[model samples]
Target: MRSISEIGEHHLIRRIRERAGDPPSWVTIGIGDDAAVVEPARGELDVITTDCQIEDVHFSRAWMSMREIGAKALAVNISDLAAMAAAPRAATLSLALPPALLVDDFDAMIDGFLDLSRLAKVPLVGGNISRSPGPIVIDVTLIGSARRRRILTRSGGAAGHLLFVTGSLGAAAARIERFEDTNTQGSYERSEGSYERPVFLLNLAREVAANRLASACMDLSDGLADGVSQMATASGTGAVVLSSKVPVDPTATLEHALRGGEDYELLFAVPPRRRRGFEKIAGRSTTVTCVGEMTKAPDLLLDEGPLGGGFAHF
Candidate 1:
């Protein structure tokens, strides 16, 4: 019931450590330090990604609990790791809390972090918290690892590589669209699972990397159009996306599939010769669709013509 201002920074941190429990064996140092320290086992490279979510800008307390917000924060960061085929290991959080925020909400938010950290096998090692003059802001830095040979990047693609994406697109955008049109995104009491949950293609990405099934890779955060354009620019190749082949949610329009953001699906380029092999390895466990092919023309085209772009923050 108490506000964060009442307990002060020291006590609030003490409570956080208490909630975090004992550090895992790999952690050489944890909270209470100027910085965390860790020693990874030999033969693995570290993969790190960070993200920031602000109240109202990224989410609203009226729609989700502070805890759900916490989980979503980690999910987005993990999505970046998924793009690199990284196995999540540890995380650090930076929180800027307003004076009027309740202590209970802080605890709930940490609870969300704990839930995801466990699911992703990423432990909370260290972080910082400070007073904010305005809305709640959470910045999470997640560290993951993969063997050097298994790391995937966006710049490896080439002409004749087929572009593949995991799962359906536009659901998150559709969810937000529903929220806006209906005036109630979802029951304020329960967060919408589609937007709250992020799909991390850890297994699939590893398979693609290990087998050399993909030539280039990145997460489809912005829509398919943007994802293809990005991969094209990074690999110095053009992409020809089939307008009819892009997968979309039942509720979303084709435009939503093309321009929606925050899908978190993996957008990858595979050689035509490896496409069948990738599909065989991908199996029926999840949807992996080939929506386009890399081209030598150096242009992003849809069905042999120019394609529109997704949401732009600028």
Candidate 2:
């Protein structure tokens, strides 16, 4: 199989552009230009988010396929936009390919990338790809838009606010633990299969924002405790998460549920009286569980205990 070097930058970019297919109607100019040109709707606030996946640190090639990595990179960043209740617009990718990588792998990555963009109705406007002597790196920048009042943030929470999280937790952590223990990726249908990609709570977030159901919101990227702590501190309040109320994946531990990051589910706060309204809005389309409550004190207590350190690079 040929390497990326064999195809050259121009040809490689051309192939990727072709794979992305035509740009959406809202995009004026896409790949092959100096920068992507997007036409956002009037009065829509632009929401931008970036996330990266690096070899050894964020992932290992031996544990997952190239396409899965690509999907994961895109999904994580998009989930950030969802936390803000933003509508996805376009995305840009910056990839550093190791010399040992095959051209086919790069192509597969683009396939995964395009698949996500299509599903989310977002366009891949532009990106830069380079050769690197070090590990493979993928940095994704996702752009989204939302109305002024629709933008959600962590600072809006206050004492007495009810805390809720979308979907289950700890599965992603369990998957990583199992992978580290066995050095095996395992099947996608398994309990930990959800770890492979993030579930962007876009619709649920929109409903929360549109109805003003949530006072604060964020995706659980750095784990439940860290994310909840961040919201509490940002809002000038404290939080207490009930251990029993936390929805844990059957295969994962409570410790994993507390500190395990990258679940990509939304952790949000609603006013005391708005719980029923928020639940009504979310309906049966998604699972929203009340896990905690905001407190007057300024500390993060996980069931009356201290919060653990979440994922950190340093």
TM-score, per-candidate, Cα-based: 0.93, 0.95
- Candidate 2 positional error at 27, Å: 1.0
| lDDT assessment of candidate 1 | 0.83
Tens digit of per-residue lDDT, candidate 2, span 135-193? 98999999989999889999999999999988788878887888888877533332343
Best by TM-score: 2
Off by over 4 Å in 1: 185-200
Residue range 218-272, candidate 1, lDDT tens digits: 8877888888998889999988988789888787877888888677688888889
lDDT of each: 0.83, 0.84
Could you report the Cα RMSD, in angstroms, for every candidate shown? Answer: 2.1, 2.1
Query: Positional deviation of 272 in candidate 2, in angstroms?
Result: 1.2
Off by over 4 Å in 2: 185-200
Deviation in Å, model 2, residue 236 alpha carbon: 0.5
